[model samples]
Target: MKVYLSVDMEGVTGLVDAEDVQPRGRDYERGRVLMTEDANAAVRGAYDAGATAVLVNDAHGPMRNLLPDLLDPRATLIKGRPKPMGMIEGLTREYDAALCIGYHARAGVLGVLSHSFMGHEIEDIWLDDQVTGEIGLFHATAHAYGVPVALLTGDDTACAEMTAWDPSVATVPVKYAKDRFAAQLVPVPEAQAAIRTTTHQALANLPALTADRARTRRLAVRWQNASVTAHLTAIPGVLRQDDRTVTVEADMPHLYRLFNLFLRVATAVTTNPPYC
Candidate 1:
């Protein structure tokens, strides 16, 4: 079996604030080490479950947080930005399963470091009118490629979000949210052990995995700034909804690509730092 791991920093064990995940913060270096260790746990679990190959993506801000030297040697890493698929960049139908490691909840939620794709630019997103965040988008995109999301790790609220989206998928919460920047964190070693064990168990039930048949999906986003929304209307088929919203229709994978382009457009028109 082949496995794909999409790892983000905010929900990694022990991280609860922007300072932990952002590059400029004093604790960011330590945060990267913790992020890498969480990913290594998933890699180890995949191998233990008879995986022939594993691919890990550093899906955090700037897409450069993971420390390559410390990652498990058994997996290949996909890092850096401009990836059309964003967090789920390396996913394909060829893989048996995908794991969303260290993912947080959507913007406006009470979870450790919770926010949408952009820190504050994107207010909310909808696929076929269903509200979703990074976790939902990642699951939809992976399912589009005929790969099931077998495991996820995050704070308690993030775990609940995934369960509400799809109850069968396994989740391991490393922290319990008290507020956006505060949580009762699990010790690093204990969190890593739970992640490893849950991943192994999730992959063991791979035969039950099935891909979503729906391909065409309507994508919409509500931005904080009207200028950013207006800029996105320049794209063909993108319709302006009032001043701060835009909607578009496209097939899976392609739709995901368009969403990434929308984010780039938003970035060009705004200078707000994420999670500020």
Candidate 2:
């Protein structure tokens, strides 16, 4: 079976602040190592569960955080930006299962390094009228391709977010959030072990899983600035709901790609860092 892993950085083990995940931060080098190790744990687990092929997408800032040289050679890696699909760039209906690694809670939540796709620029997002962050958006997109999200690894709150979205999916919490930038962390060894074990179990039971059928996906974005909305409305089919909110309805993957473009536009117009 083929497995797809979308790995983010904020929810990796022991990472509790922006300095840990941002590329220029002092500890960013160390953070990359931790991120790769966590990913490696999942990769190893996928192999343990009888996966014939695995694809790992570096789904964090710049989409190039995971070190290719350090990654498990058994799995291929998807890195870099301008990817149309963003986090789930390499995903398709052919994969047996998908896993989200090192994700965090949505914006307005009190989890470590918590924010939606674009830091503070995106105030809120809705998929089919349900509030969503990166986790839900990616999950729905994967489901659209006939792939079930079998396992997720993140902090306690991120695990809860996934659980709220789908109770059957397994989760491994690498840390417990004390605040947005603070958390009671699991030791690196322990967190990696848990991720591996859970991933193995989740995929081992993949036969019992079924993907949600594709549907018309509706997306609503509430930006932090009205200027962002002004640029968004210029896109065909994008409807302005208010001064700072815009809504669009499209099928899966297209809606996901359009949202990526929205972030690109927001990035062009805003100067705010991804975190406060």
Candidate 3:
């Protein structure tokens, strides 16, 4: 069987600082190494559970966080950003199952270094009225692709958040957060072991994927501040529905395009004084 893995840094064991997840920050290399180890553990688990191949997508920051040479030889890695599918880029109907590694909880999730995707600008995101994180959004997309998300790795709060999506997927809590920027980390080996076990269980109990074959859906964006809301209303039909929110009607393919456009606009707003 083939499996796809989406990996991030904030949810990796022992990492408590945002700097650790970005290339420009101190200790980022160290964080990448830890993130790689966690990915390897999942590779090991999937292989043990009879998977013949696995693909890993580096979904954080530049999306190039994982070291190509250090990753498991049995799996391929998809890096860089602006992918049409984002976290689930390389995934397809041919894949058997999927996994999400280093997944922090949703934005405003206390005790975890939590923020929704594009944390600096996105205040909150909702799908059909229910607030969700990247994990949930990606999970829905994965379901649409006919791939079940088999495992999720992160701090305890991240695991708790996953329950809002797929409660059956195995969860590996590699650390316990004290707050958004700090946590009590488990030793690397312990984290790896837990991830391995969860990976195995996830594949072992992997159920048929749930995909929304429906062609149309709504994705609403809620920015942290009004300025951000003003920035997006420029898109036709994307108007301020509320003080801090805007709603867009999208089919699956259009949804992907809108999401990227939104990401770009958000990134532009926060561009530093050098650009300003």
TM-score to true structure, per model: 0.97, 0.97, 0.92
Model 3, runs deviating above 4 Å: 252-257, 272-276
Worst 10 contiguous positions by lDDT, candidate 1: 206-215
Q: lDDT at 71 for candidate 3?
A: 93
Best by the lDDT measure: 2
Model 2, span 1-276: residue lDDT tens = 999999999999989888899989988999999999999999999999999999999999899999999999999999999898889998988999999999999999988898999989888999988999999998888877778899999999999999999998999999999998899989999999999999999998864445454467789999989999999999999999999999999887789999999989998999888897
> Per-residue lDDT of 1-276 in model 1, one digit per residue for the tens?
999999999999999988889998989999999999999999999999999999999899899988889999989999999898888887888899999999999988878888898998888999899999999988888888788889999999999999999898999999999999999989989999999999999999975445654667898899999998778888999999889999998776888888888888888889989988
**Once model 2 is optimally superposed onto the true structure by TM-score, how far is the C-alpha of residue 174 displaced, in angstroms?**
0.4
lDDT of 2 at 176: 98
lDDT by residue for model 3 (1-276), tens = 998899988999889886788776799999999999999999999998999889999988789899889999998889887787777687777888989999988877784668877765677888778888887877777777778888899999988888768788788899999978888989989899989888987898889765664657678988766776888899996878898898987665466567778877877777531100
What are the lDDT figures for the candidates, one per model? 0.91, 0.92, 0.82
Alpha carbon deviation, residue 38, candidate 3 (Å): 0.5
C-alpha RMSD by candidate, in order: 1.2, 1.2, 2.6
